[model samples]
Target: MATHGQDPLLHSEVRQASTGGYFAGYAASIVLMLAALLVTQQHVLTYPAFLWVIFSLVVIALVAQAALFFGLGLSPAQAWKSVSLILTLPLFVFTIGLSVWMFHSLAPRVMPDTMPGMDMTQQPTLLE
Candidate 1:
């Protein structure tokens, strides 16, 4: 619980929030989302290239959100929380990366290449 004079923002051991920072984060988030939609819909790059581009954009947006909206900074009070979050971030990234790798590795063996519109699980016709 906060003492009588303490602001709610600082009630916890975290950095204080600023109105300008919030606005910047919100605007940046919207812009990044729009950019992602445009890149995907317009097909600016082919296949994996565009996918990687969007992934990079998403990471940037997440960082901006964390810094501006969540007030993740080098404040003395917030130091431990910030450090823990940073430490755990790589674990999350590695989990996602490994999952994608596993899926791609198994895809070829479990599902053979087929026509774009064809269903791989369908039975073949004997007459045809």
Candidate 2:
């Protein structure tokens, strides 16, 4: 049982939520979102640079949210959660990559030739 100001949940020495930590995490997310918006709405970057910047922001936001909101870290107590996330991320990326590859491969076989420099006469009419 907790006495005075001690958290009852922390009696077992397990981590307990801190108001300050939650607020800091919330503030960081809000700031990051605002920054990403500024980069997009103001056209701060162009083409590939823009894409990379947005991607980087997204990645940073993901890490920050995970660490702050979920208490995820490489510490022994939290290592499992971090490891699980790392392992799962690659699978998600692979799934998306395979889907894109499948679609790209399928398009050529199923769609009629409409682009320039491609032979269009031999293939049957798309509409008829």
Candidate 3:
């Protein structure tokens, strides 16, 4: 007679135990993410728009960690495992897009106009 250990599939009890560990890890990750968000918010004034990059990095890290450890169980064949990578790609793209848009929108206002020394007055003075 073959022992349970000889079986290729894991026993229910063992699987449950592994899943419990994953859950605990996931919970800890969430707590860390929240703490990071709070800290980022508090210091945002010092960094201005740069804070968004930090936030995006934290979010991406937390999501990846959770997915890898907790296994979303989206499919019997582990289709959920791919979700972390898929989600991360879009997040990076969005972050870059926001950063670029903000820079372009704000930079022009901060710098002098390209037509240097040109007066922008809408109406000329009576003496001129």
Task: State every prediction's TM-score relative to the real structure.
Answer: 0.73, 0.70, 0.40
Residue-level lDDT tens digits of model 1 in 41-113: 9966989999898998999999999888888888776677789999999999899999999988888556655
lDDT (0 to 1) per candidate: 0.82, 0.79, 0.63
Predicted structure 1: lDDT? 0.82
Q: How many angstroms is residue 58 displaced in model 2 relative to the true structure, after the best TM-score fit?
A: 0.6
Which has the higher lDDT value, candidate number 1 or candidate number 2? 1
Cα-lDDT of candidate 3: 0.63
List candidate 2 stretches off by more than 4 Å.
1-8, 11-14, 105-110, 117-119, 122-128
Better of 2 and 3 by lDDT: 2
lDDT of 2 at 82: 88
How close is each model in CA RMSD to the real structure? 6.4, 5.7, 9.1
Give the per-residue lDDT digits (tens) of candidate 3, residues 1-21.
Answer: 235667644643245346665
Off by over 4 Å in 1: 1-15, 110-128
